[model samples]
Target: MTSGPAIYGNFTIDDLVYPNGSTRWGVPGGSAVYAAMGALLWTKVSSIVAPLGADYPITLLDKRIDLSRCRSIPKTMRNWGLYEEDGRRHFISRNESRDWTYFSPALADAASGYQAAAHIAPLPFEATKQLIEELRAGGTKSISLDMDDHDLLGNRSLKKMMELVSTVDLFMPSQQDVLALFPGKGPLEAMHQLRSLVPEVALIAIKCGAGGTIAHLAGSEEYLRIPAVHVEVIDQTGAGDAFCGGVLGSLARQGDLLEALLCGAVSASFCIEGMGFSSLLEATGEAANSRLERLRQRVERAPCK
Candidate 1:
């Protein structure tokens, strides 16, 4: 459904607390919430395919969640806490993050288009497989997966995990996750080495917290780098998810990989300036577009590459 409905994967609890002091802005966050909200900023309307706790402030859910694509899974909500100091952030609490339980969708989403995306913050590998199967059943056209800062083999079997990646279109992770996966290799070299992991993948976005991001695709001789949007960062918790949310939506909107990457960069630039999804939800598509345009203008003014 070009406009009927959209679905976002992954939902977690995020709490932002200042270690040093309070910032000018802050809010509740999660990779799933931020990205889903980001997608909503442009996609007209969409549903979130996630679960949440029974006590998950029904008001917030009423305000931000669409229940149509939502699935009730175990421990549905995440319990997380974010502490920030001098622009750096640390997660002080986290438990039962990705709790998807089913093997498939109980009811097919009544929509024509499905831009299936998941923040594989280590959802049970079996659940991920089943989720993908469900997406396929629903005729999902594009799928993007993000691996967070965890041992690549922790929650899932290695072979099964790689097989899952092959079935998707975009595979990404934070730069730190890449290092943990393949220790000792320089970032560029490690990216080149990623080819051995997922040869069928389209784009591999490596997110650099507070730094920037770079995308590597198969057959590309060089990595495409996008610098970070400089700002007084309050929290870095959900920025990566925001980037993927932008890529998925923009790619769906324009059918342009490079343009989507640029959008992801611009979206992420906006994601880091605040605590979580609030900053993103606070801006309309027009506002985001204008902000991105200005960022582009700044990019043009930088010393020519």
Candidate 2:
């Protein structure tokens, strides 16, 4: 594989509450952490731009991940997600210390060398737009975005979402996110409507839990349905973020959409096998390739028109 571009992301800490009344507090969690791990599995140059709190354990991250761009903050960003018995998640609370409502010029400067490709994890609409603008101005070749249900259903305006989508090379959103974005529409209809909203996006990937992903490439009337890898799920947190990382990493290295999708599917499979990025610690390129081959066999392509 060719040398991958420097991958960058934002990070967060999580406080999870399960239906069983158990809780995991102050866990080192975020889209950046999972996405970086997924990218690291394919390439060595990966970094996360986040604010680290005094209480966070920086040593837990892999040595390959560069935290030079991250800031030191008085308190870490905290989020609460309550899981129901039916696998639905409800975010109960959020306390953000360092406001990322707008883009950070310091982060833009730190991201100078790694402009080959970047993945913007779930952030405020304004932040996402600003980051994309900064990266594009800094000569970044490819940019990807991952949107969650919260982002879709939150206070963001449709115009902001459309502008953000049109700016990125790839837009990866969960099934629930798409449903929320285009309410009262089926998956295909929602995807088409989204495509109409952001006709310039090179690819739109809808991530379906357990079922897999449906990816539509620009200028193509057909889309690929890539199935998810079967695994015994331990915790579902960060799976989608890992998937975004895998795709961005693969695309940066190989520039092939199909390969990227497969890599993402495999990465997500590993993420779900254990709790909070633990399974990924034991993941190898060989193992990922093995699963990739299996998933490639199950992928189906059909016309979207």
Candidate 3:
């Protein structure tokens, strides 16, 4: 552990993937950027731990982003590809640019120290565990994880990733990613399968795109469904990450789960109004709270019982 505080997220990126041309495609996607910005909304200091190539931005650690911590390693370069249909998308990642060789606790501290909480997404078991351990050593607990990088249902290749799930406090995943990774039945069935797979997980949240999210954890089986605030959704790229960041960030800073979840949902809702994380990166906490208050009113005013 680096002996400091820093909100952080670890991810794997092949290249920047996003929509382009006639068809919605992924060009250069930035997951760390999205997650870092979202987490920063709540946690005081945020950092990033990931691998990139020479073109990868070593100076990025000190520039542009204000992560209390950040480390981008050099690896063979490549770009990520995305294929979107009807507001939904999938990834065809090639040349994942990360060198597990350089990722370490010392590096993380050197990047962003003296912060609170952490978010680990798009990162595998080893990386996630190492970072968590580092953060924990700094006297930080309560970490949130998005399981998109684990590849859970594929020939048991994600055994290690699955094992690491127990170490996290909040387990997050986009509904589509979970479905694709474990195709079968509906949401309840999917939750059941997930519970069977990662029983230690305190919560399992599935972002339902424009529909919001349904979550169950802490012995709650009612499937807490929180819908996204009605708005003009533009690029849905970072909605899931925003949701995770929103929830964890709020919880870490405010200790309010419902508010955190609501903030997350609102952030996600806001994401659809712009390309990538433009909405989130552009907005402030005051704006988020105002928007969240408005969304809550809509949720409450929604009639038909």
Top candidate, metric lDDT: 2
Tens-digit lDDT string for candidate 3 (81-166): 46455455654445343333343334445235544566666654455567777666765667787765335544445455567777
lDDT of 1 by residue, 49-140 (tens): 55444444435532544555555555434444545443434443344543243312333432323554433333445555666676767777
lDDT of each: 0.58, 0.77, 0.59
Q: lDDT score, residue 62, model 3?
A: 23
Query: Candidate 2, clashing residue pairs?
Result: none
The true-versus-predicted C-alpha distance at residue 62 of model 2, in Å, is: 1.3
List the lowest-lDDT window of 10 residues for candidate 1: 296-305
TM-score of each: 0.77, 0.90, 0.75
Global local distance difference test of model 1 = 0.58
Error of 1 at 146 (Å): 0.7
Number of the predicted model whose TM-score against the real structure is largest? 2
* lDDT comparing candidate 3 with the true structure: 0.59
Ranked by TM-score from best down, the candidates are 2, 1, 3
- Rank all candidate structures by their lDDT, best first, as comma-separated numbers: 2, 3, 1
